[model samples]
Target chain A: MRLSKLIAFAAALLLWSGAARAQQVSVIKFPELQKRLSRQNDTTYVVNFWATWCAPCVKELPAFDQLSTTYAGKKVKVLLVSMDYASQLDKKVKPFVLRRELKSEVVLLNETDPNTYLEKVDPKWSGALPFTMIWNGKKSKRATFEREFTPAELTAEIKKFLL
Target chain B: MKKLLSFFPALLALVLLSNFVDGPAGYQVGDKVTDFKLKNVDGKTVSLADNKAAKGYIVVFTCNTCPYAKAYESRIIELHQKYAPQGYPVVAINPNDPAVAPGDSFADMKARAASKKYPFPYLQDETQQVARTYGATRTPHLYVVTRRGSDFVVSYIGAIDDNSEDAKQVKTRYVEQAMTDILAGKPAATSSTKAIGCTIKWKKA
Candidate 1:
């Protein structure tokens, strides 16, 4: 019984670690992001730009997570794009995501030149953190917010396009 | 009655059009920036007019608590050291509301400036009017102003460089290039750039 309990504890530990490891962030360039943005799909995309060190960005992350859970199996997708330094992917970004147990899909934006990429994302964006973009390819509708959003506000924004 | 009803829709449309026509608030490149008198960390009031020998100013909106501001602190110090002698002194400003971000309070600003041994005047924009006027949305935002007669005209507005994380890997020094071009009586090759940074903590409305 003692041996069985120890084995169960070890198995649980391994599974927990595996779950944490699965949250590793993928580095993506602007072209890939553009392709994702331009893809013809019925799914509405909620792409949030954020960073580990940004206090407001971190504070609003749970809203994104809630959004992901609430919209699961629906036509809405939440993508949390980390603007943290690509060099700190392993040291900072990955660890923070794991620590927070972020449920939303997180990717580290690998593009260096903001002058070009900032316009690519949205012409009006001043490259500020905690910015969010919502778009529906099916309906040909899009919206962008350059500030933090509550879960309800995020839900309402995404719902507008999804409907 | 029918004619009056049709005019109501047009009146509503006019109101909406007026809101859009107002346009985005704050200054753009080539706009004239107003001088501000703000308290420095050294407990003295400083202004652009105080620097009598200065040809221009490198106005940087930075604060004490932001990680991006901390990362660029040394670089900002170096910018002051290099440019102050060249008649373009750096003027650092903390625009974040101390009430919203206590770490950015005046006391904290003094401590950080002292510890870093900052050569430039670290001023606090208590009213945050300067930041709003400059359209500075993030910490460590750079605005290069050139003096024309007595007034200052904004020449460049944006990031310090292409890379804020690694100085060694920086390919283009946007601020430096702009200042050098201005010094040589040439237009800045690159007037504006953007970088990811912490949003300024504004006071609660």
Candidate 2:
């Protein structure tokens, strides 16, 4: 009877910790994001640019979420970079990220002047959300779609790089 | 038949090569548009080359799904109602890729037109080439042109107005203000403003 109570207590602790970890969507500094990218060698980095208010961005988010889970055990990392306003980090961004139950690393991109960072992130990007970049240390493949994508379509792209 | 089928791959290759040779994407001011053939809601083809009454045209890259575009829809219609008879007709183009935004499909477009009763031509950019030609960055992005002698000159390229939200708080009616100047044969007071709206969904390069 004592062992059963101990097991239940441990389970509750595990669940609480998991929930806490999932809720933390902090404003990831640019340097930290770059460092994380550089540190992870031999792993494919799928970074998706998105915003909370953008309809298409919200629509296509599930596909990215599915992609992250499907490739979790592999040498793949999915980073969902929210470009929502810095002020919205708490009121909107974190709640949305949490509600979506995002499996990947979620970060509120800490940048103000889009003119400064748009090209820096990817020269081809026109500051469009739903933009995605696939990087594997050596080369970065960038794609900007002004529209939403199905999970299958997103999976196809991932498969190409995985191979 | 077998020989013809075997050459299909080569034929496809040639077509792809020619598409690249059409020169770079985008159009600039002062460019004369000789044609404006497009389908209407009732499935009727309309063209600018046939309209002799038009002194110029207002080509706007807009969509039904975008809130920004929807907000400006009434204003676009007003422009058409106010200026079309005076020789400036507004032409709204849906430049979004249907694959990305399925609601932008022709069927949805027809439904939207019927529902809203748009006064202007809401044409579909089948291959999105026309949108690329204009270098449109977002929905509700406007490009105004007027016929100068025999050519079309860009009068304005930017926002519908200064304010995206709160029409009551509008300070500058950039598009309308430009139209007024163009109608009077005077140079536009402000020729450009910051472009805003959902980004144009260009195909993956």
| TM-score of model 1 vs. true structure | 0.87
Which stretches in model 1 have alpha-carbon errors above 4 Å? A1-22, B1-23
Model 2, span B121-201: residue lDDT tens: 788877777777676777877888787666676777777775554467667787888888888888788766553368776
Clashes of each: 0, 2
Chain A TM-scores, per candidate, are: 0.83, 0.79
Each prediction's TM-score versus the true structure: 0.87, 0.59
Give model 1's docking category: medium
Give one digit per residue, the lDDT tens place, for model 1 in B12-105: 9998896555434577778988889999998999989887788999999999988888888999999989988988889999999998888999
For model 1, the local distance difference test gives 0.86
Clashing pairs in 2: B27-B133, B30-B154
Top model number, lDDT: 1
